[model samples]
Target: MPTLVLDTLVNAPIAIVFDLARSIDLHMYSTKKTNERAIAGITSGLIELGQTVRWRAKHLGVYQTLTVRITKMEKPYFFEDKMIQGVFQSMDHQHLFEEQEDGAILMRDVFHFRAPLGPLGRFAEWSFLTVYMKRFLEERNRIIKAVAESGDYVCYC
Candidate 1:
């Protein structure tokens, strides 16, 4: 398994950042490069605990679909989503939000994933998947931070 952690500071309220992170529309917008979409489950609006979303996207020149469920949530503080079915052997992503002393929102993302194929998979993870996924998450967070700070997140709701 490969684990990735990312932190971003947004000059916005924690609630706005949290809601933007879970907004299906915002996710789609953030991943426009991958042409991602929520095709099933909660296709739009904020995703709540116990809810699931099926995402269809083009990654690494291949089209794929992955289903994930919100396994845990704590309002504007934290939320976790785990993969129910995907190309990966397993995947879990946690989103956390904290209000800083400066009143800005600090957003953190922890992502863990394992690919298939045993040793080959481990090699892939260490070699390329890890870096690739890190960039993917960074790009997504950049969009979230921008949207939240600019108050454009409301347009996605």
Candidate 2:
């Protein structure tokens, strides 16, 4: 399993960050390159546990549809989504938000992924996906932090 953990401080309230993060449609705005569109399921409001969302997007020139559902939810604190069916063999992402001093928020992401080909998959991750994917998420975190700090509604379209 390849795991990535990233943490950042956003100049926003924990509730605001949590609310924005729990909305499935806001993901597209947060991501930098994964230009996704929510096709089905909850498009607005906080995504509750067991709620699933489908998205269609072109990743690396290949069109794909990913369906993910909330596996865990803890108010303005933590939420985890599991990939029920998607491009990867397995994917689980946990999003966390915490109140910090001076009224800022600490946001973090933890994701685990497993590929199908075993050793070949490890090799592929070492060759490409490892840093590539990590940087992708980091960039998205930056976008999310920017938007949340600005306290504006972003168009994920």
Candidate 3:
């Protein structure tokens, strides 16, 4: 299992930032490039533990679908999602948010994933998947930061 972690200091309140993050609509906006968006289930309202959401997206020019279930939920702080069934062998992502003295937020993303194959998996990771995942997560963070800093709950641009 390889773990990839990416953290960002966002210029926004913890609650607002967290709310924006949990919003699927905003996620669609942020991932315009990846063609990622929530298609069904937990589309709106507060996301709680055990809630599951279906995701559809295009990665590497191919459409990919996955259902993720919330495993942990702590208001205005941290939440985690585990893939019920997806392309990868396994996936667990946790998002954490905290407030700064200036009222901004510190957002962190931690991901753990296992390649499908065994030793060949390690080779694939070393060859491409690792870098791909890193770029994917980094791009996501960039969009999140943009959405948070924009001060608009909705991404209009």
Residues 1-157, model 1: lDDT tens digits: 7889999999988889999999999999999999999999999999999999999999999999999999999999999999999999999999999999999888999999999999999999998999999999999999999988887877975
lDDT of each: 0.94, 0.80, 0.82
User: How much lDDT does candidate 3 score?
Assistant: 0.82
Tens digit of lDDT per residue, candidate 2, span 1-157? 8899999899876777887777666777665366787888876556788899987887767888889999889988999999888878899999988888778788999989876688988887788877877987888778778778776744431
- Candidate 3 stretches greater than 4 Å from native: 44-46, 154-157
Q: State the displacement of the C-alpha of residue 43, model 1, in Å, after optimal TM-score superposition.
A: 0.7
Model 1 scores what on Cα lDDT?
Answer: 0.94
**Backbone clashes in model 3, listed as residue pairs:** none
Provide the TM-score for each candidate, comma-separated. Answer: 0.98, 0.89, 0.89
Worst 10 residues of 1 by lDDT: 148-157
Residue 109: error of model 2 in Å? 0.6
Superior by lDDT: candidate 1 or candidate 3: 1
Candidates 1 and 3 compared: the better one by TM-score is 1
Q: Whose TM-score is greatest here? A: 1
Q: Pick by lDDT: which candidate is best?
A: 1
Sorted on lDDT, best first, the list reads 1, 3, 2
